[model samples]
Target: MTNSTAKEEILGRIRNAQKIAFSGKDLASSAGVVTGTPGEHFAVPRDYERTSDMPREEVISLADERIADYKADVRRCSAEPAEINEAVKKAVADAGAKIVGIPSGLDKAWVSGLDEGKGEIRVDEGLGVRDLDALDAIVTSSAVTCAETGTIFLDGSPACGRRALTLVPDVHICVVPADSVVYGIPESISRLRDADPTVPITMISGPSATSDIELNRVEGVHGPRTLMVIIAG
Candidate 1:
């Protein structure tokens, strides 16, 4: 195996050994380490409830206001098939970005509608790390949306292929049907549970941003710089 591959294999073995040790198993054979040490509770806690001071309706109102702010310049329309093509074109044109789709997205006639003169358009499934680096933007369809927060959900369906495309690229253009827009996140939970539970669903509200340091705002640090939404009419 190559050096990188061999190193990764060794690292995986070490992680497995650590897991076995942390799970109260004897890992003397693997890592020459003993169990029942003082820092043995290496396991991460998964279940925890968050306490919020704001009441339910107040919280809902807050979310509603935030959604309104995000959707201010954003437009909406009735759910229709034709709007998909229109939205894709509009997002690409607006961003001045080239378009690239995943494997299943290749045959989409909407993709062919892109202007090659203005930007490059390609349909390829082999969008590995390197290929992803070359793309300017990714367009996808959502499984659902939250009208209360103007949030969009991408469940990595075949049409939505590789989650990174929606995340890694500088811009993400997601198309959602108006009918698919639910009242709130709670309403989305039911639909999500019915869909593939294992699918990595990304809930995005506006663009990637954070105010961690001194509460100062910064955008596109962890995800896309711009999140464009197209409400299919």
Candidate 2:
């Protein structure tokens, strides 16, 4: 149970696996690793479930309930782009945010309602921390969500902008596609491999909060204080 004991057991497993692997038998003798080839890969057998048996709608519902338990607002909308944009607009309006922030690649329709109204839009065109902090709220799209954990991921994709865009703002309005919602962490990880490793992956279970200081919970210390999720299906 100790860290040392656990490490030894893991190393033992690698050594056992390496003993049979032919990739680089000599290199595998040390720490259970074959030679580090540029494009070579070894598939490790896993017993974990890579897909869920629960219905997809049930998965989304679980994600909704869990995320809401974190004190974040959660809602569902039709999967149509127009409907998602409308839901995003409502969330921002409900917050009474005057200035809104969007990454450069965010869908224009997502913020069109703001323009029609009096809300001012700030695009993330290389905005720094200070600029991002100045914004009242931010709108973004999510990559994948884990229903069981009520966790969401944001890789630096076009819809999901750089990590800073979500971190600095006071409020975050994220749109989640229903199809991207998975039941558990295992399934979530399996769906996330086709991206560059350099891109930062942010996993958020709730708003940035901590009870570490005197056991009194404080929000927005590390990231956005308010999280509004719009699940579009």
Worst 10 residues of 1 by lDDT: 48-57
Candidate-wise lDDT, in order: 0.66, 0.87
lDDT of 2: 0.87
TM-score, every prediction: 0.64, 0.80
Model 1 C-alpha lDDT per residue in residues 1-233, reported as the tens digit of each score? 99999999999999997888799965564676534456566655535432334444454444445545663225444455556676677778888786554436533654556756767765546677777777787777778776666777777777666577777788777766655666656667666776676778888888888887699978889888787766654
RMSD per model, one decimal: 11.9, 6.1
Angstrom error at residue 9, model 1: 48
Residues 125-162 of candidate 2: C-alpha lDDT, one tens digit per residue: 78987888889999998889999999999888878889
Q: Show the colliding residue pairs in model 2.
A: none
Each candidate: how many clashes? 2, 0
